[model samples]
Target: MMGGARVRQEEPSVQKEANSWVFARSFRSEEEAVRLANDTPYGLANAVYSVDAARLARVASQLKSGIVWENCSQVLFPSTPFGGKKGKASGFGFEQGLAGLKEFLAEKTVVGTSRPSYNWQIYKKA
Candidate 1:
């Protein structure tokens, strides 16, 4: 409910346990919604619900969280890559998918010449 530049302010809050809910004042615009959501120190995950697909996509893109759910929450899939920020201090990198596999893998490069007589000295001029 927006009228002119008036902004309704409510108490900020957080819940420690599961299934607990905290309520805050409704946002007047999309920019306000993104700002309020990102005001928190934590940005692990977030979710948005809307009948408009384009609006949902636009909002989801601007959210600060690493993972975002559209019209759904916490629907984890094995094939989907999951991880927090690069320096999240979460004790792990991505957990699933090809990107996750690369975290624990060590890659090495190898080279060889197949010529019968090969002169490997490049600095010596003939």
Candidate 2:
């Protein structure tokens, strides 16, 4: 609705895939905004702008995306885990999290009973 009355709209600055950004007017309510944002196939990232921190946090949690930025553009850090939800856009695994660290380590499970019991098969009557 922001870009005239056309149903489909894209940012005027966008000229190619490298410059992709969909700019649309806000819906009636926050729920509608979340619904429209999550309807996409790719849950790569999403940005929410709001003056109220609580409301911004609430909306961010409802989004289907793995990465959510509030009142700011996308910024990456070495410590923060980077990845998306289930979809083609989502990578194999997180880049900086416990899960990501696990990807580089070997997994092993140790099993044992608190009390040891001998097998009766050795003295079983045949």
Candidate 3:
């Protein structure tokens, strides 16, 4: 763990309310930070600060967490899928745009019928 104080500083207010949880602080470099983030047994969300877009992309790819916030904290949109890696159980499918809407619905496919029916399946199941 980076440090209790550091995690507290980087985490959001809601996250702070979870007494059972521990937050890790921001890393100096994307590499160092990602290393620490990935090292943890639980792969959750990771926040990165990078003024450079290229650097952010590089770091985002390396992070073990499912969600990576560049120069920001937390996932903001419902359409944006949020989940965790490693042992942390968050989610398993995308949650944004049409893809996200699909997650909440079921699709049925009818074949060889008088009228053609579209397939409605959950995003993850599909």
Candidate 4:
């Protein structure tokens, strides 16, 4: 409920294990929904349905959830960055993006190989 209102409902045993869950028929505005989603202690995931692209983007940014779906309820691509915030459980690190690919792999940052080695040595002294 909004504005600190409380309601009573029978929840399943599995739900008790969850941190919290909210089911609302509709939100007055996307901003309100995003605020409610972000106010939770958990940042697991969020689902949003909106026809306006601008509103969707604003809501997406405001959500503290690790993954947000706009007009859909799933992550479709493997190249998108996905992770949970506020210590919510996540499936894995950046899944299919460059960041995700580099998680398990080692990347070397070589600074001087392409340039003159003497130039790097000179800069190292400074």
Top model number, lDDT = 2
Q: Name the Cα RMSD for model 1.
A: 5.9
* lDDT, residue 85, candidate 3: 66
User: What TM-score, over all chains together, does every model reach?
Assistant: 0.63, 0.68, 0.51, 0.56
What local lDDT score does residue 96 receive in model 2, on the 0 to 100 scale? 77
Model 2 root mean square deviation, Cα atoms? 5.2
Residue pairs of candidate 3 with colliding backbone atoms: 7-23, 7-24, 79-95, 79-96, 107-120, 107-121, 108-120
| lDDT values for all models | 0.66, 0.67, 0.62, 0.60
Query: Is 2 or 3 the stronger prediction by TM-score?
Result: 2
Error of 1 at 71 (Å): 0.3
Q: How many residue pairs clash in each candidate?
A: 0, 0, 7, 0
lDDT of 1 by residue, 70-125 (tens): 99878888877776556443336677887678889999998778873585766755
- Answer with 1 or 4, whichever has the higher lDDT: 1
lDDT of 4 by residue, 37-74 (tens): 56544566678777899988988888877678989875
Clashing pairs in 4: none
Candidate 1: list runs displaced more than 4 Å.
1-25, 87-91, 106-126
TM-score of 4: 0.56
Model 2 error, position 15 (Å)? 17
Q: Model 2, range 11-126, lDDT digits (tens) per residue?
A: 33322222255556557788978886676556767788999999999999999877898988678777777667866355565777675686688899977665436433456555
